[model samples]
Target: MEALLSQFSFLSSQALQDKNFDPTKIDDLMKFFELEAYNSWAAMETDLKKDVDEAEYTMKEAEDHLESVMDSAMDEFRRFEEELDRTLKDELDGLEQVANNAKKMGSSMENAATIATKKYMEAALVSATTTMKSAWKGLNFNSKKIHPS
Candidate 1:
């Protein structure tokens, strides 16, 4: 029991540092951690149950041990839950940021395209107006021309 506790403690204490826990890696690590913790608790519970069945201790002692084991298991479970929650929150926040950035980029691109189209349209209008003015001038419309009514 002591050895099992020590092993669990050792594993729980092994924290990854200076590393990016991407989704895949984080998922894998969480799975392994969860498995180890669950196995440790299961082994402890099984052992205690066996002892109780074998009538190795007084009923009071068995109850106390069971309570102690439950408390320990709950503490471990809570720790794992909290860590998982934090990681999920972090990942969700990151995804939200990425979505926000994409939205901003799309808006920026739309603005740029609008501006470019406006400039091109203005240039085309000016060119057409100039060409029409020149064509009218070449016809000398201002010059007098006799016409039968």
Candidate 2:
């Protein structure tokens, strides 16, 4: 029994020394995601403001160019419509980029979790094996003394 206790203490201390659990990686990942999200949101907001400003400028130019001429007004209107279409396309592309970045972040987090779980399982298995080995040795010693052959 004393041998078993000493063996268990030694093995447990060794397992502690070889621990693989690291929490800093998780904190770093979260910080990265937070910064990425803020940057994306800021870019989208800037693009939206610029697009609105451009549309307003075009409208002002259209008003100044018109002088009771229907054909000229129609041409300016067409130009404004094309500019609006381009702005919408730009916004859509930005949204798509943001979605892709979010997906990448999620996958990175999942991979981190998987790695941590694997490390934990490996440590548990090592401890279990060590305990079994110690118990088997103790049992064998006692059995030999009892048999004396």
Candidate 3:
């Protein structure tokens, strides 16, 4: 207030009037200062109100940004989860296919072994029969030579 008084020439011929100058009196220094002070106060109030309004706007913008970030984060999380699920399912399916292939291969190997064993037994039987027939022919020929019948 004193700074305002010093900056502006508060002392003048009108303010030189008596100390009991009527406040309601027009064209008086007291009335002019009173109006000036009210105007200054009103201007300060208006500036403060503008500041408050701007701060509210900034706060609302910040809240909106935070909400958007949260929504994006949730969406990203859902996508990651879905991707993980798909990878796991695909891996399980591959494993199942591998298991099935291994089972089929095992069965095929068993059948091949059985066929080889059957072939080996048949070949042994044929060899034994040929040997027996050759021995019988030799015995009959030797008996005819010894008896001369």
Candidate 1 lDDT score at position 102: 100
lDDT: worst 10-residue window of model 3? 6-15
Each prediction's TM-score versus the true structure: 0.53, 0.43, 0.52
Query: Residue 72 in candidate 2 has what lDDT?
Result: 81
Each candidate: what lDDT?
Answer: 0.82, 0.79, 0.81
Tens digit per residue, CA lDDT, model 1, 29-89: 5677678789989999999899877785577787999999999999999999999999999
Error of 2 at 35 (Å): 99
lDDT by residue (10-63, candidate 2, tens digit) is 555665676773545445555765776788899999999999999999988887
Question: Of 1 and 2, which scores higher on TM-score?
Answer: 1
Best by TM-score: 1
How many clashes does the backbone of model 3 have? 0
lDDT of 3 by residue, 1-35 (tens): 56545533544434466676444443454566678
Report the alpha-carbon TM-score of model 1 versus the true structure.
Answer: 0.53
Our tally of clashes for model 2 stands at: 0
Residue 45 lDDT (model 1):
99
Prediction 2 TM-score vs. true: 0.43
